[model samples]
Target: MTVAALAEVADVSAVEDRHVRLAGVTRVFGRPGTPKSVHALGPIDLDLRRGEFFSVVGPSGCGKSTLLDVLAGLSKPTEGTAEFEGRPIDGVPAGVGVVFQEDASFPWLTVADNVAFGLRRAGVDAAEIARRVDYAVGFMGLKAFAGAYPAQLSGGMRQRVCIARTLVMQPRLILLDEPFGALDQQTRLLMGDELLRLWRETSATVLLITHALDEAAMLSDRVGVMSARPGVFIDVVETGWEVERDSRIVSHHRFGDITGRLWEKLRTESLKHLRDG
Candidate 1:
């Protein structure tokens, strides 16, 4: 993921579509010379291919979530440009969905309603909304809890509801910032399996920001490593797992190899971040 590589990716016409593109993008807080200024991210060059599951891993406080925010159009770059499908992002683009680490399910809304919220807000007709909600809810294995409120669901189930809500929108690209971080290890494994299935059935490109190297290695077609703050891609490792990959892949020896590679890249950066404090 060098700047030269990024330029080549942006120019490649072999792939008729690129779900996301970034060139020298940077995000900074306050004036350039101000003492209070913080350089969160910079000169990031990336091209996320359509329908690929890509994960980003780095030390905590390395601006991973800031990268997600930029991609989701929740924040703009202070320099350079960010684009989705070749168009500059002035706001959250169409056909892009986002899910966060926090529980996003509405307390008052039942599982079905929570999943249907976005479509309803967009003025989709009741019939269409019902159809999409039923599919998303059932697909997420929440049909049994369709009538259950967020208060009644387990933590993992609540995250599933959030994902179902995102799935219902049928986004072409999904930005996930530690969407499974709150779940227990076993639950995270199960959720990871479901996410793979969702990606397959929906054909959506996924860009996930996560601290879990195992999760990233098992779930992504490629895993990007970021340096400590003012985060930039250091390397992108190919997992070589098939499209039908799941958490079970963790038992494979290659999983350890991939995970170790990610850790090696991150370890120094993480130590650097800690030492700086």
Candidate 2:
């Protein structure tokens, strides 16, 4: 199908499935009509189906993070619209969670307390908050370390805690900004498996931004590749992997081919940026 036709279908599906939708979204920094101004992103069109894991990949400075910021309502698009569940997202929308690359865990608080923080802030009752904290901590495999401080945990464990905090809120949509970027290769692969399990269990629509080609292919049902600055999605590739996918997804016959195609598009953009400079 044509790009416009696909987008039109996406809009129709968004209304019925309560998906996240972005139409002609653009983000610009600095003043318009000035040399200092930077057009960082868009006129990008995207639609994320409910319970689907979508990942965005591109070269550095390609506005991958900017796209996530706009979706999370952390920043508004300079032009166009971003909507969640058919409602325009003016600010941080309800039923959404975000996990950044940096450690978000509180040093002083134990894992359980850290997970419970959001519930407490939202005025969730004490008993329900306790219930959710227990569930999330256990689900993220932090049950044994529920009372342990952040400093005592390994990098992977600490990241799990951050994820648990987001999970406790039971968000319908999750935004991850290079959540595994800080980890070693082995740790990142292990965390990828854990994230896949969590995604399956929660059935939350996920939008992840990452520079890792393998990570994106392994974790996403559909992967969108963006251009270099003034980033717009140049193409979207479907992995065609089953929902049971994990780190071992690299073993799949088509994995290499899919990653190669993504790299072809992404590499050209990165080189273009260098040549232009």
Q: Estimate each model's TM-score.
A: 0.95, 0.93
Error of 2 at 93 (Å): 0.3
Model 1, runs deviating above 4 Å = 1-12
Please identify model 2 stretches exceeding 4 Å from their true place: 1-14, 275-277
Residue pairs in candidate 2 whose N, alpha carbon or C atoms collide under 3 angstroms: none
What local lDDT does model 1 show for residue 159?
94
Q: Residue by residue across 15-132, what tens digits does model 1's lDDT show?
A: 4577788999999978877999999997899989889999999998888998888888889999989989889988899999999999989998888989999999999999999999
* Candidate with best TM-score: 1
The digit string of per-residue lDDT tens for model 2 on 85-177 reads 989998999999999989999999988999999999999999999899999999889999998999999988999999999999999999999
